[model samples]
Target chain A: DAGITQSPRHKVTETGTPVTLRCHQTENHRYMYWYRQDPGHGLRLIHYSYGVKDTDKGEVSDGYSVSRSKTEDFLLTLESATSSQTSVYFCAISSSGGTDTQYFGPGTRLTVL
Target chain B: AQSVTQPDIHITVSEGASLELRCNYSYGATPYLFWYVQSPGQGLQLLLKYFSGDTLVQGIKGFEAEFKRSQSSFNLRKPSVHWSDAAEYFCAVGTTTGNQFYFGTGTSLTVIP
Candidate 1:
């Protein structure tokens, strides 16, 4: 639970539509990350932010954008959703940097048709 | 390139049986290794981690992982399996100075009665 929450626990969207998922954390962790989970893929990093307004692309960041305007909130936006982007999204936070343990929030299941 | 290999995609063990999940990673320098477990419809939870310390690391839920630098492996083991331990286990590797993590495909554990 880690005091993390993801909005839109489940959603079904049409292809080519825009979608945004929100992650809010009460813990003031310095690092936040977005990951997508899929069958056979396990979990892959999509994007991550180390501080407000400082974000970096992950292994699968194409077609996705992220914003971290504040310490407690990180946003993931898909400009135009595709079926391939349909998967479970998870938000994670760590007190320190990458080497530290990460606590994950309940995931958001997105479906694109 | 960094990669994590989890040979077993699924494992079945009876209750009270011993369990071991294999994880191997490819990284140049000293790597940060971690094990995480996920239940149905739940977020990933940290089982244990190995940064630098004793080769054996203890984790939550009576789980332990042995880090073998020689073999580039960090294998998770539990002496007794519980029915509640049926879940998906993932192994991840992170760099000491980076914020990205590479995760394994994950192994699903089934605890049979």
Candidate 2:
């Protein structure tokens, strides 16, 4: 198993509140990704960082933001929580882009009331 | 745009029964495909991936997948399954040059003894 961990495994926040989820990896992988898992929608990419301070938006980037200031840490923030943002978020790491296998962290379950 | 479709939302099978999950993808070029398993409250674990070379790719946990170009399908199969294999399965397609991965809605597997 890859050395990856997500903080705040479970969280509940009221609407219009700010929340931040953290993903930490010991593998020093170059690529890190944030995704949200929802029923009937699978896992949708939120954001990804190729290297320190390099990030890009994914298919479902709205209402979410990410930042990676260091290789080992990637953070996903919900500027203002919404009921629609409630989902299980997963963080993954890969040594290479595209077809390379990605290892995932334990995941964070966030609830917006 | 690249997309993945997993038609079966849920499936139930006997413990010793052979298992197959269907996955079809849409992409302009040869696509990179992958299958991942997710247990309750856990993260996504890579089961198999198809990049190039042999059409049949073997992966962890006694699983295999075949990539068919003509059908635009990459189906997952296992000769025999264990109760531990009961979980949600997702099929994904990777972009040509980015870390982005597009996933299917997912299929929930129920193994009965």
Candidate 3:
């Protein structure tokens, strides 16, 4: 298994509060992605970073932001939490090469009240 | 736009029975396909991927998938089903050049003993 970790394994925040989830990878992968998993909907990409300080928006980037200051750490922040943002968030890392296999972290469960 | 469709939302099968999960994709070109398994409250794990070469691709945990260009499908199959195999399965499609991936809604499998 790839060495990936997600901090704040579980969190509950009231609406309009700020929240940040962290993803750390020991494998030094160049590509890191943040995704949300919800019922009736599969994993949807929220944001991804191709390299340090390089980021891009995904299909569902609204209400979320990401940063990659260092190669090993990627952070996802919700500026203002909403009830629709309540879901399990997963972090994944993969090498820069052609191999598209992504190794995922344990995931963070967030609930907005 | 690239998208994936998993028609079966849920399926039940007896242990030792053959299993199949259907996946259909829509893409302009020959796309990269993948299958992943997710246990309850756990991160997604890659099962198999089809980039090029043989149409039949073998993956971890005794899983295999066949990529059919004519049908635009990448169906997952296993000779025998075990209780451990009961989980949610997602089919993903990606472009050859881009690293972004789109996932299906997923199919929940229940293995009855």
Candidate 4:
């Protein structure tokens, strides 16, 4: 499990509402990533943080933002929730070593009505 | 662009039957490959990874993968399928420099009684 926990394991929100999902890791890893899993899409990277306060956009970064103010916490926020944004969000962390194998959190299922 | 391809969207195998899931990657350089499994309502778990050394890599849950550089494939295989093995499998490729990974659409496996 890599000591990773995601808050709000399940959430339901109305359209136009803002929602934030938090991923916390105890290992103090250097890399943290936010990904959304959907049918036929597998998992798509929304954003990732390589270091504290150092974040970068991923292939599907529109309408989503991430912040890593501290090493142990990474937050993903949806400015305005939409039905299309409903999916399972996962947080993963990888060590600074070159292995590139990531440990994933359980995941958060979000529904936008 | 680096990408992963899982040709089969779904597969069915009888319990105790041998199983193989195909994965092909498109990358320019020597790539880092990985296999992950996701159960219902659960997070993705790392099965195994191939970086270098021997082409055959062993993973958890009685799973193993072989990396074929010539074919750009890292197919996951198991000698006997168990009902517990029913889940979605994903194949991913990472670049040499960055930890970012690209994942396949995933294959859903069904173990028949």
Measured against the true structure, the TM-scores of the candidates, in listed sequence, are 0.98, 0.96, 0.97, 0.97
Candidate 3 per-residue C-alpha lDDT over B1-113 given as tens digits, one digit per residue, 9 for 90 to 100: 88899999999999999999999999987788989999998999999999999999999989999999999999999999999999999999876556788899999999999
The deviation in Å at residue A95 for candidate 3 is 0.9
> Over the stretch A1-113, how does candidate 1's per-residue lDDT look in tens digits?
68999998999999999999999999999999999999999999999999999999999999999999999999999999999999999999998866898999999999999
Q: Evaluate residue B102 in candidate 2 and report its C-alpha lDDT on the 0 to 100 scale.
A: 86
Highest lDDT against the true fold, candidate:
1
Q: What value does DockQ give for candidate 4?
A: 0.65
The candidate 1 chain B region of ten consecutive residues with least summed lDDT is: B93-102
Candidate 2 per-residue lDDT, tens place, A42-77, comes to 988999999999999998999999999999999999
Higher-scoring candidate on DockQ, 1 or 2: 1
The numbered model that scores best in TM-score is 1
All candidates' lDDT scores?
Answer: 0.95, 0.93, 0.93, 0.93
Residues B24-104 of candidate 1: C-alpha lDDT, one tens digit per residue: 999998899999999999999999999997999999999999999999999999999999999999999987656778899
Scored against the true structure, residue A27 in model 3 reaches a CA lDDT of 97
lDDT of 1: 0.95
Task: Name model 4 segments beyond 4 Å from true.
Answer: none
DockQ of each: 0.84, 0.80, 0.61, 0.65
lDDT of 4 by residue, B20-72 (tens): 99999999888889999999989989999999999999999899999999998
Q: What local lDDT score does residue B86 receive in model 3, on the 0 to 100 scale?
A: 97
Evaluate residue B85 in candidate 3 and report its C-alpha lDDT on the 0 to 100 scale: 99
> What's the DockQ of model 3?
0.61
